[model samples]
Target: MADWGAIGAVKSAVNIPVIANGDIIDAPSASRALELSGADGVMIGRGAQGQPWVLAQIAAELAGQVYRGPQGHALADVILKHYEDVIRFYGPDLGVRNARKHLTWYLERLEGGMELRNLIIRERDASVVLKRLTEGLKNCGPIIEVAA
Candidate 1:
């Protein structure tokens, strides 16, 4: 958790908006941060990694808006699309290497992810990695799609 007292102090001293960040992982935490720190808003870091839709979810909660995150087949589609984008942006060789970390993060919270994590990080071939991802997603169960 962030030092709310310090944030409050800073907010008082500054004319610009004060956005609190640190160890805020969900909408409730964000709301608490705003209340405690008297901040204009909150910023998320590690919490948003691999789970891109988290920010939107948090924002919606704060704004009292309705938002539905992708799940099941929709999640698989998003992950596949992200994989393809990474490959296209970096090209096969480097992209595969770079995407390993992202793939691991994406699978971390999934039910049967350890095996998939091993396969994804171990394989150097993009096609093989993608195939493994497809199979892994089948076994991983429901997933929340992270926006790009």
Candidate 2:
């Protein structure tokens, strides 16, 4: 749980905007944090993990807008694009190493993903990782069409 009381004290003592942070994972948590802290806003850190859409989801809740997370091919597209960018920036070897955590996070929620995630995380070659990932997505159903 977050120390929302401490945050309230800070808000009362300061004239500047106080943004409550830590442990805010969803709309309900974010709302509760603000109600308790009386802060101007909240910040999301680890909540993003594999699901980058969390920020948008929370924001929409605040604004009373309807939004849903990406799924199926959309999810595959986001994951694949992120992997490609990481590889481009870090090169094949280091990229594969760095991307394991993110991939692990992304795939953890997928049905029947444990063995596939373990395989991808252990592989050293970037090409093989990408191949396995693409194939793994296919195995899940509705394969992502990565643009060539």
Best TM-score goes to which candidate? 2
Worst-scoring 10-residue span by lDDT in model 2? 139-148
Write down the lDDT of every candidate, Cα atoms only.
0.82, 0.84
For residue 114, model 2's alpha carbon misses the true position, in angstroms, by 1.8
The residue pairs found clashing in candidate 2 are none
lDDT of 2 by residue, 17-69 (tens): 99999899889999999999999999988888878998998999889996777
What candidate 1 gets wrong by more than 4 Å, as runs, is 65-68, 143-148
RMSD of each candidate relative to the true structure = 3.7, 5.5
Cα lDDT over the full model 1: 0.82
True-structure Cα RMSD, model 1: 3.7
What does candidate 1 score on TM?
0.84
